[model samples]
Target chain A: MSLTRRELLKFSSIAAVALAATGCSLTEPTSENPESMGSVGMGTPAELAETDAPKVVIVGGGWSGLSIAKYTKKFAPNAEVILVEQRTEFMSCPLSNLWVVDAIKLEFLMHDYLQASRENNYTFFNATVVGVDKTQKIISTSDGDIAYDYLVLAPGIDYDYSEWTSDPVLERRLRTEYPAGFKPGSEHISLRNKVLDFEEGNFILTVPSGNYRCLPAPYERACLIADYFKKEGIEGKVILLDENPNITIKQDGFRSAFEKLYGDYIEYLPGSKIINFDLDNKKVETEFGEIIEFADAAFYPKVRGSKLLEIAGVAKDSRFNKMEADINVFTYEVNGYPEIYCTGDARPMGFSKSGNTANTEGVYVAKQIAAKINGKKEMPAWESPLTICFSAVAMEPILAISINAGYAYDEKQKAFGFTDVYANEKWDGRVGKNNGKGLMEWAKGMYRDMFNA
Target chain B: MKRRSFLKVVSATGMMIAINPSMINQVLRADDGRLYKSYARVQLLNAEGTPMTEQMLETSENYVFNYPYEGTTTLLINLPNESAKDVSLKDEFGEAYLWKGGVGSRRTIVAYSGICPHQLTHINKKDSFITYRKKGERFEGHVVCDGHTSVYDPEHGCKVMKGKAPQPMASIVLEVGDDNTLYAVGVLGPDKYHEFFKSFRRELKEQFGSKRNAKKEVVSTAVAMRLSAYTQEVIQL
Candidate 1:
């Protein structure tokens, strides 16, 4: 008898659990809900015995991954969606930045991704994906090798010290001792303590070589730290060591406010590339002819996709090791291989590697796969993503919002051009007395949209 | 400096009209040619001159007006002695700058602008107006900026006392209406009083002095910037 997607999900869940006890795999056929999943609860599990739905495998229960999983279930409730995440609780990276600053505690950042999976009637695997076989359309995790027709990857970023060429070992030593505090938890708290007791000296901040997760974050950190110092009446200068020639986005406005008000307190040293550092001396040697001693320094190392991307042969580019896909259209399939799909930060796109972008890509790719499986004539095209960033200078906060949409083909230039709609502005703290308030709201809303929507 | 100006004639006539020291009444009878007419009748109540009395106050559902002095023209309202509760009053600048939230030997609703003279931040009564009385120093009423912790002296025409706000707080005239209600009659300072004066309003761009590059505004910026820098430094420890 033909089983509907909902019935299949229910039966497969029982079968999945039973198989788990016996350590076996019950390879089942694909299933999906026939009615559009715009609204929730169209038919009961008993009536869902005759629908065909696609099977989706989502790796990472992060903002992007969980968001895709939840959206896929919402758009096609009968579809068999399985989320493979290593963490039982998903922590937000957006707000995690504050954890390093002691602005907020960790418990406030943690959310139960496992509970969400169960409520959505989707399968959850609390295991890490070691490999993805593109040819076989199967993912080999610590738990078991799971097969899937459609795959969405939002497995975030990782740091690399190799780019610091002149002094990789020294930089690594600093990290070993000081910790990056990029991810939440112990590192965040340790760093937060270091900032609280900071006294008279030169505090240095280094920007990463490539596209980091959040662009305006380091600058925001500087501003917050500067505000902290002014309040304590400790005399010092904050020296920003930029690997790049100039600051991007709110850097100009930040410089204006910092210089006009706190210029005496801050010494901006441009063209300072972290070629190497002497951890023993606590001195950093930059590309420029300057060796500086720092009381405190935060090095935002270069970032790239997860190592799993390289192992799966899903990543086409070696430099960043990201999947090369036609971003104009949502197609994650390898050349001539239509069954397998890739999405999220792993996929190479024109937009910056951001959590928001990854989440958008995940939903877009998931819908495409669902459409192919359901034989829907039209599918939503890959639209450009929107970005909202909040930066706080001193006590006042500013916000910038930008959206990218539309595409263009340059025939003469033999290149593709895109038309996009974008909007951005610095937060006028006058409107809202509190800094970072809107940012907190956006972070919460974005997280909910990704996982709960 | 018109010799026929109402203020000039009033000074020459030697009339001892006791105006609220904190208030700037621009209703000079000498300036009849001044393009604007008074919108409402104001009662001047000087807390410094006359002790607050219950008989001098008019209580309404929305507001309570204090008439300290009996005059054909009233422009100031004094607070009642027994009334110890916080009373908030919005200045002519549409900024609510005063709230009597602190307990003191005596409390008065001195006429002060809600706008921070240093920057345009609204002077919030809750955060502003708390001055720790120094030894041998008078406890000048303070006004705090909600945007920044800039404080101003309410008694000294809203001068910056201990904060980043550079300009002195402007004052407005308080008047009792026909219904015994208190209203903001006019503002102090030639620039402030002329801000809404029809023809003069068109000329006035912003009340904050543009040419005066005073160092008074640095108190807030300096403190905040120093604290932020210190936090960045200590966190490394």
Candidate 2:
């Protein structure tokens, strides 16, 4: 629909408020014309009994997997939706930076998947997916091989430990002794305890270069740890070593905070790539041949798609093995295999590999699948999804700075592009404090929408 | 004809059928009124209670005032007479375009939100907000963020001229009173500061009732002047 610039501004304001109020509920009315919504009644129980119905299987229970699982059923009720995830409990990595500094309890990040499965009316199997037989249309799980008419892979991300060393002993040590804490579990707890135990010494933090989940997080962790040190009156420095020359995203906001607020506490060293670590000496060597000693360290390793992508033969490279999806940007369908879809951090997309973006993509893909099932020729391209990130600069009064942007699909480029209007806008201090509070509300609303709805 | 009027006619006849009726109503309603609500109006006055004249502003290239509410500040630009031209600039939201050089026409006067859009650092003595200087031969003005050296061109719609700022600084909507006193009526960009002041004023009114003694003790002379100025601007608008 054509709208004047004035109308567009007003509409966007209303849309922003609506999105804030209702987390990720972007479903169009499906009750009126089920066929118009998508191909439906193709996966009914009676048809399943007759072996004519289609069974859609979604792997992983992370942000993307859970969202699509719920939305697939909502959009196409007749489809037999089954979610196969290894983990029973859902732990969010989005706001876990708050947990690192003891600002928020670890329990706040954990949620049960049982409620989400029951509410969405999808079969949840808490079993590891060992293999996928594309020819047989079956997923080999630890329990048994489950058949599927369609398969969606949203297996999150895994660290690329290839660069560190091939020694299994060293790999085991790196996993246990120096945890990345990117994944949510025991490692996160260990990292938190390490920060609490740290006292009056140089605590080094290394950030890897290239594509990783949550680009702004390492900088955020630095700020949070600095704030923690300052609060506890610990005469220590957070020496942040980055592979990139500077802060990748929201450069102005983070750089200003580093200089003005945490300059004395945080020794930011950019373009200092960690070549190797001397675990015995508690030292790290950069590419420039500078050996820095530290009391403790949290080395965030570079990430790639899970091993499942490589095993499934979808990944192109071994270093950063991300699945290449021959996707119709509007439909989110893989060109060759209409029944297979790849999304989240595992999929190679132009968009940032973020939880928010993943969640939005999950919804989009699910709707497209439903549309295809209901005999719809084509689905409309989604309005650019908004990704809102709040970076906490201080913890006492809870001051944070926010960077929000909306992405639109570029048909010519076949990629998602950010518009100048809503991109790179920020608010800090009291306004940011309010935004930090809003993050909690947003998380609550997001959980409720996904599970309770 | 006014843009709003033309839009109303076009929306009624052509676009109404294609668009949702509720959306049309919303658009019409928004267009009929000012986009932003006036939070506080501060009167531009010297220590002596006289209205600020064009002559007083001409002496200085830029005048900085500490807005009474929430310690937020406003930077007033006094354009050179010969160089002064009618400049129309769109706000950050692009909802409305604010026009400079009208009404009294003594000088092309404009105001900008003094807080840095990058980190929200308010202008102060230690870190001056805007510095006007001559670069070689031509005069140039820059809104300098003391926290970081993010510079914004004051004359060119407060656009980021240099440094790492993401967006332009917010524009403060000002009105020239009959007595030539500058009054801050509204702001067109980020209104978080305005919202804070509104809440702060509410808290003050709750603590101190209609008692003049409480009001006198609580409100500063600058704040009082602003409140009076805002009321006058509201009436004039």
Candidate 3:
């Protein structure tokens, strides 16, 4: 069951094209004995419902990966698209703030990856990627190694607690006890419990700096949790400790909501960076010598590209983040590795790391992959990824605000800039129930597009 | 074997197991200039139950009707100018098809599926985010979906004018009867009917009593009404 690195490398040297013809495989032959190195390398090859068609192995099943899986097969019908995700089922990160406060049911954010695969004509493989052999075009997963004609790596962001503390013990405690619920599943459940169980005390939440996942989420979470406290008549207050200078996006709407609606239940502190955390005493020290005591906390730290990028040897530190995919910014391909793409939040682009942006970018990447597979000389014209973000500002009526824009590449700056910007940061003053409806509709349409639900 | 020919066979025979539910939009322009099979011959009528003629339809009014299917919504508008002739259109999956211009004396009367081809954002009962924009509007003269800001040119076969809609809105073919009554006979180019049905089962059930009833193909007559009248809220962004 164990594989040495040399053995795995040896197995990858077999010409992938001659695998079916020469009857060569990574799968171990039938063996009655459980242990004895029946195979030269790792576990047997994954028993997939596969074909001789061009294999497109996409790792990650988030917004970007799902869209790429669905459209790549649609554009190139003969390509066998297999999406590898670690999670058993999909729980949407967007609109999860509403779910945390019980505004929407858990089922609202839950979707079946199996259904998506069936309808979209793709295979959903539930496995975590351990490493990727760039030379042999083989992805080493927890289950087995999968060969790909075209490989896409879209592992999302991973929280960076290094800035706060370098100690592994403190990092483990922070990760487990005060789970940043920004990720999907169990962390959200923990944060929800913290909100429901609070009697009357200061509940702490932190916002990180840089281009984080869902720029407006931390603010939205603060607002919704505060709204819940206000609605329940709890004497609790949300002490929002933001490392950033100010609210990141939809500032007008969130600021107004904080002042107008949850003024008493929420306290907005901008540059209060936590220098020391006394987890045992429920106290934290700010950078400017300010001592604050909290009943509970969910410490969100700065983020970087997922660790998988570094393991694959395709990672480079970007201006804003670390260990991001070292790929061509325009084409999204590894510098020397042709046909291997890295997308989604793992990308080093300064574009707002959100679901809509990733989904749109996924479609563009899918088209390019399809064009190559179909033997088209010219790649399709590059299109901008749309950033359509909706942030909830209030509950009861669930009023909200939104922003819609597309990105354009700048030659001089060597970066992407937002274009066709339309901002509607008007809530509680000139907004109605329609904006809330828009928020739900936007999520619904995005889910439908990705899952074919 | 070329990929196009192989795909043609796979699609025509409906033999592809994975993509069977939505067989790639078959591009068929028969002898009569029809791109798809003729569906229910639903006669467009006003809210008063009177047959709606091309001349009777007014410009700037957001007229809507459901044809071909019970739950599907189609846009019926009288454009201020003539629609372009024989516009080459591509579907979301890059299938090529042609859309003949509006079928009337002035060629100003046109119909397109109310469903936004980008993401299936359609005109619904609670909110109608997609509609034809008239003069004095931000996206004036183009059919705009405010949900994602995809604009379509109603006068030129609903080609994407701005924003990120992959294809033009699916065209709805109409014919003016000898007596001047308008009738929707078939859908032009490619559409999102299969995806629409699969995606909106919940909404369809709540709106139409059951999802099965929502998918029943339309029969002889369907009531054509105003976009505002069809939905309670038309939040113009």
Among these predicted structures, which one has the highest lDDT?
3
For all candidates, state DockQ relative to the true structure.
0.01, 0.03, 0.51
Order of all candidates by TM-score, from best down to worst? 3, 2, 1
Worst lDDT 10-window in candidate 2 chain A: A38-47
The sequence of per-residue lDDT tens digits that candidate 2 reaches over residues A380-422 is 4564444656667777666666655556767796656675322
Shift in Å, residue A347, candidate 1: 3.1
Candidate 2 per-residue lDDT over residues B1-237, each given as its tens digit: 123331221122222211121232222322332222333455666535666655566522556665524455566666543223334443332334333332236545666766666434444333342344324312244555523345666665566665434456766655666776666554444434633233234333454442232223112223212212322111000
Cα lDDT tens digits for candidate 1, A1-453: 123344434543554465467553222211231111111111112221132356677887776678678767866676778888887777766656555555666766777776678656777777777655454455656655555667776576566667665465666666766666665555666667777778889888777655565666666666667766776787766777777677655665566656765766676666678766776778888877688998877677766666655555544543333334323233656445565555555555444555655655555666676677667798766544434445555443332222233334456954334454332233333322233444454454454444442
Enumerate clash totals for all models, in the order shown.
Answer: 58, 8, 0
lDDT digits (tens) for residues B50-134 of candidate 3: 9888777888688888877889989889998888876776666555566678878888999999899888899877778888888
Q: Name the candidate, 2 or 3, with the larger DockQ value.
A: 3
> How does candidate 3 fare on TM-score?
0.89
Instruction: Provide C-alpha RMSD values for all models, in order.
Output: 20.4, 14.7, 7.5
Interface RMSD of 1: 16.7
Q: Give lDDT tens digits, candidate 1, residues B132-219.
A: 1222333222444423234554434444555333245554444434454334444433222222222122112233232122101111
Off by over 4 Å in 1: A1-53, A166-174, A234-236, A318-330, A334-336, A395-435, A451-453, B1-237
Q: State each model's CA lDDT, in order.
A: 0.49, 0.61, 0.81
